[model samples]
Target chain A: MPQQVTRLLIVFAVFIGMFLVAAAFLKPASFGEYGHYRGNAIKEIAAKEIKFVDRKSCANCHNDNSDALAGAEHALINCQTCHGPGYKHNQWFEQNKSRFMRQDPASGIWTVDTILVRAAKDIPEEYKLLKPNERDACLKCHAINAARREKVVRQIDVTDHYDVKKKCVECHPPHAPNS
Target chain B: MDPNYQHLYDALSKVEGYIYPNEIGLNWGILIVLYPYITGLVAGAFILASLNRVFKVKALRPIYEISLLTSFSFLCVATMPLIAHLGQPLRFYEMMITPHLTSAMAIFAFVYLWYLMAVLLLEIWFDYRKDMVIWSGEKKGVLRLIYKVLTLGVYDTSPKSVAVDERLGYIITVVGIPSAFLLHGYVGFIFGSLKANPWWSSVIMPVVFLFSAMVSGIALVLFIYMIISWIRKQKLDMKCLDSIGKFLFYILIFDFVLELLDTVHRVYTAEESFDIISILMTKLFFTLTIGQLLLGTFIPLLVLGYFQFSKPKDAIRKASYFIISILVLGGIFCMRWNVVIGGQLFSKSFMGFTTYKARLLGAEGLLSSIVIMIIPCLILAALLWLLPPWKKKNMEAY
Candidate 1:
């Protein structure tokens, strides 16, 4: 019995040792100075999600923007791009105090229309180039949000619905106050 | 269509039958589906091997090489489906080359390597080494060359060497048993981990997959064993096949019970996705439930059970076994299709469905899949020719 026990123990140890050696040898080959921690750190960054800003911050400047965006089913969208970087625009208008197209005298110099045109220009070309009547710009991101999307185009063609006809500005102004 | 589906149609109209974000394509679900099928083959083959090596079921001795060879063949083709399903198949080596050790998929890749090199190939070589020596001298031309290469330059045909080969092969077979389980069971874990997909989130998936694998494996071996015997004009081993049938009966029953239990649990709880799932059950899965579960699984089980216990004669029993085996294969395949493709048919919205049509040829087509499946059988045939498993000298001589 003692001999059997010792033999079993030795055999078990040998198996573990063999497994460990095989694992060590078969560790997959790698290249360059990008080793271990560095590689994992880079992977961690790559896996990091791209954040989308929320829509509430844009509403502070363009009070009626929300209502217009709501009509276009773009209530979920952030205003950074369409509003041409709200912080910088607001800062420039505040310092310059230009009264061009101002909706109110005491309010900053910029009016709703001037901001609308500027915001429209700053939009990415694909969204900006959408057919004026088509809801492509408004529908792209909002398509999955069916309830909101229905308020804007209501209906879309089969080919277009699956494609670019769904941009943000199709049914709403880039920067104008809501009607 | 149900009036409830009106809302679904309304939702579908907005996207115009397109997937959301463009990132979530058919690739993910397609890979998920193939995972179970491949793993099931592995499990089935291993179980067949176990019957001979572990349990010492003598009648199944004929199928001993075929089962190991089938497992090896299937493992070779298993990853092809996954590779075809990848958006970037070229970058797939990264899955193994630079594994995400934390991920279950990474662990699975390692497991695959372990089984391929350590389990299947080694055991198979050990089993066939004796035969390879015998054939190395007899054949000429391509067969001679093939035999020479396969023997790893070994010329030994001594009794002592054969005994050593048998002992080593036995040890490998014992080790391979768990590796086989891991191969299939991990697929279940993959689906079960996706908490976001309520359709897949369940602990029972792994257990169900394992048992279904056993059912499929046993049925497949029974089918092939009969065909091979018939082809060779060899005497049919009725007793051995009856034992196989009995095992298949138990596993198929276990699989059916688990599936029923899962459905009952889901229906009873009426989870958040229950409404949509019930609709799916009544609609898309109706054929699967009725045809596969009721007719395919249960009827075959009854037939197999009756034949095994009643002790029918060689001819009648053989015919019934063939029919039951075919039914078992069909039933298990339906189970896979339901678990895999069925889960993806419905949209995340739970209101709409999208269709998938497998192409006949080219990449991601039915033709390629068929070719992949056939390659293994061809390899096995070549192996049998080289090994000449039927000869008395090549036999285990228990």
Candidate 2:
């Protein structure tokens, strides 16, 4: 019994010892570098290039559209909310300015790069640009549910408000939707 | 906008009611369903082992060792689905190292570790230690060395040493019962405490989970025991089988009643989320009404109840128990599915519903789920090979 107890202790010690050694190896080197989580994650995130260019950059080129949007009820909404991201569009224009100048309207020859247009079809759903005529774009925010939103400026239940197929832009313009 | 972008507009056209755009994609999938189901098995199997050890139910003696091993096997893989479901599985250790006290999720690492390391593993080691030591001396070659290593130098077969081992094992079993309850009950609390989701926010969630866990775990062990006995061409312990069936019958009744009560309360309250929930329930009619309630619970209950009252031949009883066990397992699994997946089907805004289309591939897909389910069975088979859990007479004959 004494020998058995001694053996059990030895076995338990070995198990505990192995566990500690494994844990030491498995633990990240920068584990406690910050606090609890791996500190390297902060560095990794910091190293990535910024993706969403702020609304201020869009105002530089399409000042008229920005001015119209700013005067509307949807003033708080960012330009990218409808136009999609401007970074790639801005980059394309900067790289291919000469192509924009070489277009001939009579011959229907436009040398402009397709990428510069920010085609809604080409982009992913998350970053897709909304056209002025798309009623669903307005409906994304305006589609009525008292349960979901706190202060709904105007809510429209699409089924009851108008012809089922009619676009919102047919009556209300996109830039100043309520106007 | 490009004409190709029309599909994006069409996507939202199908939405009948208002759903938060962010809520369109379900974060919890089939893998989350698996998490509770697996953990429930662990708790259930452990509780069954306690029936023999702590309660001293002599009829349950045969499955006592298998139940402990079954619990250990499932417990080992129980957390895999949880880790797999994480956005960053590599950062999972952070939950353990730096636990947030306010977060219900953070409690998981502690509860799981305590149950695994302290209760399940320790109890299993103590229970098997004497047998391992004996087997170590009796065997030769790789098997002998493996047994020797498992014994952990405890070669004491002395009556006094075994008495001490027995006493300690009893203590661990007593400790294990509550720990088992805590293990699965804590899982229930993780979902139940989410005040945002009306479906999961109920006090009865933990009780429902605990009883269902007992039902599933007992069913699994019962089925596995019957199958193993049949494979070995050994005489099925009718007494033991009947006792387990009886326990399963009683537990199933409790589980069914609690589930019905929860449903009744939700329907009667007619809360703001009630209408949407009603629609969601109708949509899930096949899985909830027919699969879980009818096929899984009620039918099995009726059959098991009949067995309780009537005296049947061993062959007939065994077949009935086997079929009923399978049904009970399916029923419990459906209950878990209903809780995890069904809870997410309705929008938190109480305005709409979304569908969960389980992918056949990917990390948390159906393929992965099937593979995960098979893994524990494989582990059990391996454990059985390493340490055969049978009586001395059966062992010698084999």
Candidate 3:
């Protein structure tokens, strides 16, 4: 009888300990500051800030991209969220404008010519941030199957999509989005 | 593509050539089939054992011990399919440790445990205690040690102890009847309760499963009884053979009637899934109707019924029993195939049809099932070797 009682007591104590610990964790995790923010969309947005270049600046140069943005589902998404900042593009123009002046006039844009002509230069390899393999850059917001998103989509090795080998911008020209 | 043609083409194009459920291949269907097949064996074996214990049919006396051993053996292997089915096999203990009471699956774990430990294991232990004690005392080395552990310090082989064991065994046999029924019947209930699947959703499923379990159980015991008697060169138990044949006749009739009623109800209702199901019956599963139901169930019924009524000579009776046993076993396997594969044959969108082909040795395939089924028989063989039932001496060795 004593052994049975002792066993019962131990079981009871263990259950009580578990219940109290769960209560302690649950009250704060669910009802307190953390839980309060979990309900707030604004807080969630603020927590995951987008490193976006001002869209108005991109519009000054590329009006077609601005027009395409108005019709797309990704219109609400900021530009630099997909493509990194315009600071490097600005720097490239500054360095290559002299080379651009000597390009043939009958040929289309000097952007292509200048790249081919000045292909051999001391460009920092890291500054060319064209990663076609990273799907998280696009899937950050576009979740098709939300239930299994993390398990299925998030971990999908994106390099397998050979079409987007140079990143999403290959098909979706970021600066000149419509073209 | 034309609009109507495109829809048909798209559905056809989505069908994987040899693979199934394309996401996880054919594991799901394989698991579903094996789950009920193993459970049916448990239900059938238990019901066979119950005949001698509960119904007090003395002709079934030869099979009573074998039936108990069969039930116990089958019960041990029954959970292997479910474990193999699990996505995370190692986490199976969660079914016991922190079960979700609301889920049908969670309830099944408790139900299986109740049947295993409380009913099957307990009854087998009580029935075999006397024999185990004597075997233990006679054995010399490792077998003696194994027997000692199995006996669990209970050495009392007095008449009082024997009487107590017998009473407990009898009590367990009574309790096991409902547990045995629930073991397989609940599997039917699981399918029947799924209102979404038109093929599975019928009120008659549980009743069908229960009657069929009895049919298969009786047939299996009859098969084993004949085999064991042949091995020992002993005369076949005529009374036992007759009783089994009669019981098989009644249960098969009950099973056939219920199955017929289920099919009739489905056709009468003429629900949305009727056309595809009709195709399944006549076109896709023509063998199931002509081969399994007609040639297997109906003809065997006639054969067994004729033999039982005629009181045939020993050789004729034995031949009929063997044929009937084969037919009943084949019929039951086909029934499982119909339930598992037949339900899935209809398109989820209620559009068209699909086919199922069982793989031979995939991870969750026939190899696993064959291994699981054989393991129990191997265990039973070891058990028989340890304690030979036909020993001549009556010494209290323990």
Candidate 4:
């Protein structure tokens, strides 16, 4: 090769070599083990703990709340859907059951911790249960949009809906929405 | 509320029709518009430069180096808008490495690098290598260091070495023509291939984009050529300016026709999305009809077309060319704006529309887009300082 050609070839070779080295080292550990994707991604996703504690678990403790929810418009909906993830909620309650009970065993009265429920959005990030009472909390799903079909979601014309001053929860019981 | 989204909230209240809450914020803002516009200039400028080298168009000889540097300067900053627009710019290398093979977007990193490293950089190096070596020896201090480093230790200015440089540069230019086409055509494909978006999806989108790139690129170089001559106090080369204007005129017509054809097809077919698109047209009346059509296409076409027949005075011709070049550049920018911003104006449902008001602040705002546009010119200014393409004092030294 001519002197210049040799130098150009070396430059090309250096780029190719760098690319090969980067390709080798910069990959995910499970990449290309099965196909073009990461082979272990499925196992990683499958191993994740469930966040939505379903109705059966909630029914064990709150019989009255479960009774109110049963056979209502929201009967099919997950309680955690509106209240945020319940894994932490159930775990917190399960672990701290004695904190809710009275000092006397016979006294069945229950009171929540004074530290909790001090503010409107008092529920911390650790325990994910929430009490959403705002108009937008309901309007997110219920507000009329061209994208939403009437059959799929009972769309409401928020402009014409009764009392913008009042929230959806003020008129209808959230658990048993017979209205 | 996050203070950054105050603009989006402001836009939301002004929205004429109902939009999905998600659609209230345009995911692709003005920064996205600049992405294609900048890249189009690169493709267009490279193709213009290649006309001189590969096709052996002698009239275009004057602006070849300038065109290459313009293309290079713009190309350097081409990815800024894209990276800045990205929600996570730190992980941009993810697109370079382990890209999703199926996506048109994922291929951009490779295409850009190939054009930059393989085509433009190589060709420019081969062209300027001889000059750099000479400049390194003559100069002293920090400037000497720059020129020395630029030469990459290649000091050969012999007849045989010069021949090799010429042959290699010619080959790269020939390859670069298609690569330039691919670079901008692929930019169009980024939007065009979206089956879900009726506004963007088209069979001729790449062709339209390529032609528009040519239009914008030629116009930009012509404008710069005039300005450079004025700055250097040299008599303008009328032959080169006239030829560039001719090419810009032809390309603008082609670009306009393709856009018209696309719109006519949509109007005649009266597809389900036509209703929404028609509404969108009314909303973008100023940008599409006035800015792109009236100022960008028609005015330049008339001015350049007039010059084709009549031998107007040199002063008049130069003035008209200057104005025409600016008009064509603005029109091409509006064309990109119409495609990117207009596509998102209407909801996917085809029953509602949203408005985009480019704000004066934040990374995703109009001010940043202006800054991004200015960066290329700043780069070009610095490049012009380092390697002035003007004829030097030692003309026959080589």
Give the best candidate by lDDT: 4
List the RMSD of every prediction in angstroms.
8.0, 7.5, 10.6, 5.2
TM-score to native of every candidate shown: 0.73, 0.81, 0.70, 0.87
Cα RMSD over interface residues, candidate 4: 4.3
lDDT of 3 by residue, B349-387 (tens): 565555556678865777877787688778666655665
For model 4, the stretches where C-alpha displacement exceeds 4 angstroms are A22-25, A28-30, A33-50, A96-128, A132-170, B1-12, B392-398
lDDT, residue A13, model 1: 75
User: By the TM-score metric, which is better: model 1 or model 2?
Assistant: 2
Q: Rank the candidates by TM-score, best first.
A: 4, 2, 1, 3
Instruction: Calculate model 1's interface RMSD in Å.
Output: 11.5
* Model 1 misplaced stretches (Cα beyond 4 Å): A1-178, B1-32, B347-362, B396-398
User: On residues B253-312, what C-alpha lDDT tens digit does candidate 1 reach at each position?
Assistant: 898899889999999999888976776666545448765776668788788778656876
Q: Per DockQ, what order, best first? A: 4, 2, 1, 3
Q: What is the TM-score of chain A in candidate 3?
A: 0.34
Q: Cα deviation in Å at residue A106, candidate 3?
A: 35
Q: How well does model 2 score by local distance difference test?
A: 0.81
C-alpha local distance difference test of each model: 0.67, 0.81, 0.69, 0.83
Choose 1 or 4, whichever is better by lDDT. 4
